[model samples]
Target: MVLAVRKSVEWGITAAKLFVRRECRILSTLPEKQEYAEKQIERAPSGRKSITKKSILESRHIYPEFLPDPNPNWRNSLREKLEREDMLKRRGQVEIPEFYVGSVLAVTISDPHAQSKTNKFVGICIERKGCGLRADFTLRNVVDHQGVEVRYDLYDPTIQKIQVLRLEKRLDDKLLYLRDSLPEYSTFPFDMDQEILPEGSEVPVNPIQVVLKPKPWVERWERQELKGIANIEEYLTEKNKIKRELRKTPWEKYDLMKQYRKTIPIEDQKEIWTEVYTQLHQLQSAQKKMSRKRVFTSPKSLLA
Candidate 1:
């Protein structure tokens, strides 16, 4: 029994010594591996320093219509080229200033029925969609307690002028929900003064949350998961909330194919912007010059 015990003790000591040697070997190799990793990181290019400027990338937002239809089946290169040529020609004639969904605008259109031979409508932009020549926007307003909406083609020849009274974006891309909320949210004065943003300043986003009315909304607001609405839960019942949860397709956002189909490729966008940037820049410069002249020439009110 003593000899058996001695043999067991010797085996245990040998196992422990092997474990210690293996651990020491791993520890000794770690510093070399870490130094190699550090050298590789130093050799890699700095992404932040090599990145493109925001101004260069903003062309996609500023000239969205220039991008062709994302649907590959509807794309025709020759037709798109012709449409772009015509769109540029129209832009040369009319100065359509930068505006977004929440922006208040005054649109003057030629109308033979009106006494002045033109009619003006001031409203907040609710939606802007379509691509190329088919691009259009909807404006919403409340006039004399009546909610009114007007859709205008971006390249319409009848449009005499489009003045941006309030140049700001909303939290949501489309403000159609405003129709069910309240008329006050869409109302604007006809003689609203223009608000000018400082040069080189980023466009301001309105973070206002809208309160929705009770049930019977045009859309299923609960299922949409809108970010700009505050009181959506007040209108949702337990059953409605259950239905919303069941209808949710959270995985759709992760579908790479769906996203690719919905957006123009970056290479294609770069090519399109390269073709139109010079003309667009020149037009913007001319608009600035004309605006400056108007400001200086306008009669100033004498202070009392």
Candidate 2:
């Protein structure tokens, strides 16, 4: 009977020890499990929030080309994301200035035919078309009594420089009529000096309206409702003038979605500019520093 009692006591002691060991294990793991649970809870909310700046949103208007094409058929959010990444990468390698249709530009391009393996062309920007990677521009100037216009792709790898000699806008979005205009209006000296505007000033709009030569234009100027031509009626026949009045779509200005379809939504624009803002800001800062250094180092007589 005593032996049975001792065995029972020993078994009771072993069970108590096992119970304590299990409790200790649970107690020891409690903090870690709690920590892991808290981490997951914290992480769940992290992915929901993103930061954007008002300045970046406002500044997107200055770089409209950075936004993806807004055509529904051509626009894929995934594709836009990839294209924006590629564009930002390209911008990091080269300097592209803010310019308008009327801005005078000098572009240096790698040319195999040139003796120096490069060629520089200077002219007034008559048009800027397309968007994203396909963005292109046309420069018009009179060379050797003949009109010369060069259309350049903004993102072409062979382009070495794009210097905005005069940063300004024109009355019209396109100056293609300059092709048919008098030679004096389209002519700009190839060696013309860059015109720098005052600091913190808005780009001035050249209010000069061009006068077109008599008939045989690339397009019917009368039918297009162009505002930049002063002598359009001189070239238009009475029948053509009547047709232009009949073709006018006065209601198009009120079509909100039509304009919206041509441009990225404000919300999407905010997101894109936010993503690339830091990189662009850094580049601008570097450029400012370089310009300041040049001003300080340049000879006073030369600067004057």
Top model number, lDDT: 1
List candidate 1 segments past 4 Å from native: 1-54, 296-304
* Model 2: worst 10 consecutive residues (lDDT sum): 24-33
TM-score of candidate 1 on Cα atoms, chains taken together: 0.79
TM-score of candidate 2 against the unseen true structure: 0.76
- What lDDT tens digits, residue by residue, belong to model 1 across residues 4-112? 9999999768745754554222211011222435544643675554333223445667777788888899998888889989999999999988887888899999999
How close to the true structure is residue 231 of candidate 1, measured as C-alpha lDDT?
89
Candidate 2: lDDT of 286?
75
Q: Which ten residues in a row have the lowest lDDT in candidate 1?
A: 24-33
lDDT at position 223, candidate 2: 74
**Candidate 1 Cα deviation (angstroms), residue 271:** 1.1
Candidate 2, which segments miss by more than 4 Å at Cα?
1-55, 293-304
- Error (Å) of candidate 1 at residue 130 is 0.6
Per-residue lDDT of 209 in model 2: 79
Put down candidate 2 lDDT per residue, 1-304, tens digits, no spaces: 9999999999868746754553222211011222435444654555433222434654544565676666688878787778777777777777887788888899999999999999999998997877678888999999999999899998888899988877777777788889888888888777766666656666666667788998788888787777778988776788997888899999985554465455565567667777788888887777666555543221121112
